[model samples]
Target: MKQSLLEVKGLRVAFGDKEVVHGIDFQIDQGEKLALVGESGSGKTVTALSLLRLAQNADVTGVANFAGEEGGAARDLLALPESKLRGIRGKEIAMIFQEPMTALNALYPVGDQIAEVLELHQALSARAAHEAAVQLLADTGIPEPARRARAFPHQLSGGQRQRAMIAMALACRPRLLLADEPTTALDVTVRAQILDLLTDLQRRYGMAVLLITHDLNLVRRFADRVAVMENGHLIEHGAVATVFDAPRHPYTRKLIDSRPQRDVAPVTARQAEPVLAAKSLRVIYPVPRPGFAGWFRKGEFVAVRGADFRIAPGETLGVVGESGSGKSTLALAALGLLKHQGELDVAGRRWNAGGASDRALRRVMQVVFQDPFSSLSPRMTVEQIVGEGLTVHAPELDAAARRTRSLDVLGQVGLTEAQFPALLDRYPHEFSGGQRQRLAVARALIVDPKLLVLDEPTSALDVTIQKQVLGLLQRLQRERGLSYLLITHDVEVIRAMAHQVIVMKDGAILESGPVGQVLDAPGHPYTQKLVAAALAD
Candidate 1:
């Protein structure tokens, strides 16, 4: 058999006596595709980062051996010097981080950034590097490579940016590629395309890939070998077929079961009164650029065009769409965040799209955003963070009452006051990603808004946490009579929560009906395509 390209043995990582990774071991053979699977805070990402010596402000100890010319070279990757490591980083090893928006340079044009990688590592000239970058873009299946090359990170859609990032990573022709949840932000179709691209590239280049992700389905489809991590421990590792077919670990079994059933039980007509309504909602963003005549030509780019939907009291209305399908635009507009034209009625009270104040609307509706870290303020403590809405809307409550109420809400979201008291004093950085998201949910719920817009609220969480949050949301709705406008691409999540489903494409509604009807017997061809893509195993 061929020698292993990368072998990690007895890998351990610690933070201030808190050991997160406990002597986990794995190997990636030449041209091998390996997956590290686990929930959040599970040493999967740390183990992957350790390969490139990229664990910042953490004590990592591991034996990492890379194949050499004759036999192989075994070295303590953690002890490698900064100078020696620089030569190995991009030239021999490349990484595609989870969040492309955070990983890619937001300020630079996508093509120029790709060109920079080639210029630094490959020693290519300026024009040659640009051409190589374009070719790489084309290779990644990006449409209109020429026009896309000049687009900034923000200008491109989520999937396009991810492809651009992958293009840059492959530009160096590295021996190993570390992909950390590379498809987390993409839709089903885009994910299939990216996975296909990665598999094809790996076959062509014969590069060892260490894929770190929480997506078990993706691991099943792509990985040759699999490793499971939990709370910093490697619980199981084996061939993909063996591990997935008959898992020894209970964690693995739970994950497999968590894979949402493609078909949902039939939906009964919601009996509650309608709590939120949007009539002919339109959100248009103005894009102004100099024309051929050097004059600024303003064009109206319709994001959410004439959207209409209603959410019954204690019901969830799922908005399904691809990236830039205006799902989020509709969510923001519903919350009165964006300048839009629409008739919005919450709890039977008519509200103007532009003139209504957030504080006035707070009593009727609230929003939970996709990213917890960015949505939450890092400066304030959890108490102040959650209570800020209360202080604004219900000014009669004193500081002590607000603190008590905040503690109650936090506890309600599966967090304890004892575990979270420090959170109130410290900033957002002090908490883990899951805990931070729980705090975000607490903030939204403390206000007791009748309507909640869950904008990919569970997108960042692992499956177990997602289920827990979904259950909590159901409970909250049941108790508080809360209505939800749930915007997400997770079809499983839509199946679990949505009473009614709306299929959207190109800023317009393609189909709208009960969730079961849409998922089982989609009328439109586009909806059928989405259903097939989403359910493809």
Candidate 2:
């Protein structure tokens, strides 16, 4: 029989007394795509990092045998010396982390970063590295590669940065690639493209891949084998088709059952008026050309064009689109943050285009951005963070009153103010990704807003936590008679919450109707393509 490229026997990883990865075993043949899927704190990332001896401050033990001529005969990855392990990092194994914003260097140009990897792994000169980097960028579908290569990490969009990460990981042509939630934060369109790129690269290079993710949609489409993990245990493992179609373990079955489906409930009477309305909304910017020196000239760019929509009370209107499709642009415009030509109304009140005195509307309309870490202020305590809006609107409340109110609201969002005082007084980095998102939701809820604009609120969360948040949102809408204008690329979230669905592409509305009708018989080809892309597996 042909030898496996990588094998694990009774592998275990622990941090102090807490053992995160239990004794588990798996093997991957050459060119195989194996997915490690589970909820947050399930130890998937820890296990993936172990392959390259990359676990951060953790004690790992087991037999990790990297067979083939490349892995230096017999020394296990856990037993390898630092010098020997350093050589394997880029050349033998590579990883594309989940958050490119945190993983990438903000100060450096993306192209230079990719070039740095090539120079480190291969004997490439400065000039040669530059050319190779440009090719890599172009290969990853970055338009205007040469110009984009010169741009810093902040200049590019989220999808563009993720693609740049892929370029860097593949630049080394490693024997094995570890992709940890590679497309979790990407838009559906960009996610599909990235998945395609990885598959194509796998075929072209014949490199074994360990795709660590919670996205079952990705697993069905791309993975060869699926391993289900729960609380640091491998619950089940089998062929991708079998596992997805007929998951044996209860946890795995629960995961499959939890996947959102198109709403079958009948639409009810629209009793309440729309909380938010937008018509002919257009946001345009005159960007500079490639060779231009200044941010001038008629580049003829439009972020959002003629975006017309409404979110009624007690209903969720989902804006579904890929990255750069102007979904967030529409949200920002509705908040009066961006200058645009449009008619906007929130809770029967006309939006003031003067960008002044949005206090009344702010109280009625609140927003939850994608990244809670960036959205929440680090310096302020949880009381200040959640009560800032309340203080601005109702300044009569003193610090003590505000703290009491903040604690009450935090409890509403499944967080105990007493048990989580560390979170209340601490910074964004102190809380986990899921906890931070819940805090963001709590802040929005503190305003008692009639309408909430949730822009990819659960994109960064793990699957189990995502389900909890979705359930919480549904309950909030029912109890408070609240409305939501949910902007997301996640089809599942839309399925779970959206009463009305609007599909947008290239700043134009592709289709919009009742969720049942739109999802069942999509009228527009673009909408059909989106549904197809989402349900591709």
Candidate 3:
């Protein structure tokens, strides 16, 4: 057996009087990949941060014995002095944090950021570090590394920003790497690429990896060993295949069964009217021309070009694509939020150009955005957030009637005063991600819209919560005959909810057909690649 690289025993983390992480024991073998799996607030992240003493205002205790050099004796990381620990950080053990958009400094160029790490830990000169930074970017499979390194974080794509973060983490060739939800915000193809990069780097560096994530599919494809956490306790630990195939703990079993299940019934043969229809829909933005021609005319960039689709009553038409693919642009055009060149009608009513919004048409169609927390106003209470529509659409209703209507819709979305005391009076931040999403759904349903534009509704939620939300949407569709124009990049979500699917790439629909036809046996090469990427794990 390989020697243990890190052995953690009786690890505890607490903030104030609330103990979030209970004492846990685990170990990592040299060159091995171990995944820590759990939902949000499960204490997996706290455990990882505590090892490096990164958690602020928190009390951490236990023994983290790390073997140093090639054959040197083990040392307790918890008892080390601050100065000594700083030397080991980013040199012997490094971390790749989630959300590279917020993690990377927006002020500095990506190349300069990578060079900073090389200068700090490796003591390389500025000129040497800059060149090495570009090489590191190339090693991570980034295209145009020399040019990309000089670009700011905001100027890069999501995948490119994440690659820059990975390049910085690998600059020092650390012995151990900690990756926290590395691929959560990435598209399916980019997620696969990042996973492959990590595997390759691990083999070249012979570094033991401690991956903290809730994605079971990623663990199945990437990790050798797995540890399951619930609340603050480590409930299960074993080989990935063993724990996944036959989970002993009930919590683990629940997580395994949390994958989205298809419950959508077949469309009836009633020949119902189409809720939404678009023909040759195009959205273009004007950009300033280059230096010589700037004063003459602006350049035109077509965001959504020649898109055509329809959503029938009681049906879901899913738009699947990566970021900047114009899926969101199509959603905005359908909601009458953006100006378009072609025809887009909701409930057979066209949007009035350069005029007041049609009140009746507005009440017939509503939208739910991607992030529920941000979409919902922080200053508004649950009653105000969910019932805001009534003020404009149903102004004749008295205060008592509005309250009753808000409570009714809230109950339909599975939230009630019984489950949450004074539910209508509470704020958005007072609830969990799942609960906030439910509120968003209730707000959309409150207006009794015939069509709902759902933009990445479940992208920001945990697996179990996503499953629940999808199930709720399915139930509402059956009960209320709701039509949905679902936009997202997750293939699993499309398979579980969509009756018909449209594959988008670079502002064009590459393929459109039934979910089984497009996802199971895709005709287009791009569509095939997307399906293959989703199933790669």
- Cα RMSD for candidate 3? 3.6
In model 3, the runs with Cα more than 4 Å from the true position are 1-3, 54-57, 67-92, 100-168, 269-271, 285-300, 337-339, 352-355, 358-363, 373-406, 425-430
Superposed by TM-score, candidate 1 places the C-alpha of residue 474 at a distance from the truth, in angstroms, of 1.5
Q: What is the TM-score of each candidate against the true structure?
A: 0.92, 0.90, 0.86
Instruction: Name the better of 1 and 2 by TM-score.
Output: 1
Tens-digit lDDT track for model 1 on 172-205? 9888999988887777877888899888888988
lDDT tens digits by residue: candidate 3, 248-363: 99999999889999999887832766888899999997866769898999998798989998888889999998766788888988888888989987777787644445777888
C-alpha lDDT score of every prediction, in listed order: 0.82, 0.82, 0.88
On TM-score, the leading prediction is 1
Say which prediction, candidate 2 or candidate 3, comes out ahead on lDDT: 3
Model 3 alpha-carbon miss at residue 307, Å:
0.9
Full ranking by TM-score: 1, 2, 3
